[model samples]
Target: MKVDRGLLEKINFDKGNGLVPVVVQDVETRDVLMVAYANREAVEKTVETGYAHYFSRSRNELWMKGKTSGYIQKVKKILIDCDEDTLLYLVEQTGVACHTGNWSCFYRTLAEGDGNEIL
Candidate 1:
């Protein structure tokens, strides 16, 4: 769907950090791919181009997922949370979602006894 600037503007971007958390999900597999943050411009670009774009807090800049690794995420649908402060990005992932080369960023799990372990 086209990115509607009007809809974007209606979101509560006024929250702390002025960014909304976006949950990326695999459309076909129903698996969560990753979680990232997106600023207004990032959201706009994602909707505008049908690609996943995020704000890199570390670099303080906008970045497209897989931009360097060529692991682009094709957006299928975007859903807003009830509070309008978060987003869900249903996408068709092309390659690894984690920089570690895993299919998803949530490849690790934390158990009560075991420390962080591979999932």
Candidate 2:
């Protein structure tokens, strides 16, 4: 699916520092890769470039996936929830999604007894 400026403008970005949370997932495996935030400009850039772009709160700038690490996330589809406050990015990710070099950011599993198991 394609996104346009019109659609992006409709999103309810009224919550949380003028940024919307986006869940990034793998298209084939259906595994959640990571979560990030995108401001209006980031969304625009993502659609325009056909790649994932996010607003880095820490660095205070716009960043595209794989810019430094070469872990590009090619957006397959962008889904919006009913509230339009959240987004889901279905992407074909290249290399590791996590900066820690894991396949996904959700690499730890919580078991009954164990605190956290690193997968």
Candidate 3:
């Protein structure tokens, strides 16, 4: 079956670059784990394998999550933002999500009010 490109038309790539932002979150715990990018091949790879894959703009190559570290992010549900420019992946993550040994990529705490601050 052919995948629909129309479904992902709202994603914003960087300056003609092929990458789009993808946010990974824990499906059960509702905690954001990390953020990555999906190029056309990466998106197709993720859909086909049910695992998260991303195109690293910095490294200029495709990278599968947790390939070496074994901290894989399995896709549970993927949600696109209203603008279609961003992706929210409700995933089943194994072990740590970040390479830094943290549960989430968003690990820093900034000065903000009690429960509403996101970091």
> Residue 79 in candidate 2 has what lDDT?
89
**Cα error of candidate 2 at position 6, Å:** 4.5
Clashes of 3: 1
lDDT of 3: 0.83
lDDT (Cα, tens digit) per residue for candidate 2, span 1-119: 46565667788885658899999999999999999999989988898898999999899899999998999999999988988899999999999999998999999988455657765
> Please, what are the lDDT tens digits per residue for candidate 3 over residues 1-119?
23456785556666588667898889999998988888878887888888899998789999999899998988977777887778888899999998889899889987558887775
Candidate 1, residues 52-81, lDDT tens digits: the string is 999998999999998899999999999888
Which candidate's lDDT is highest? 2
lDDT of 1: 0.89
Candidate 1: RMSD over Cα atoms? 4.5
For every model shown, what is its TM-score relative to the native structure? 0.87, 0.87, 0.84
Residue 108 error, candidate 3, Å: 1.7
Q: Higher lDDT: candidate 1 or 2?
A: 2
Ranking by lDDT: 2, 1, 3
Which candidate do you rate higher for TM-score, 2 or 3?
2
Report how far off residue 36 is in candidate 3 (Å). 1.1
* Overall lDDT per candidate, in order of appearance: 0.89, 0.90, 0.83
How many residue pairs clash (N, CA or C atoms closer than 3 angstroms) in each of the candidate models, in the order given? Answer: 0, 0, 1
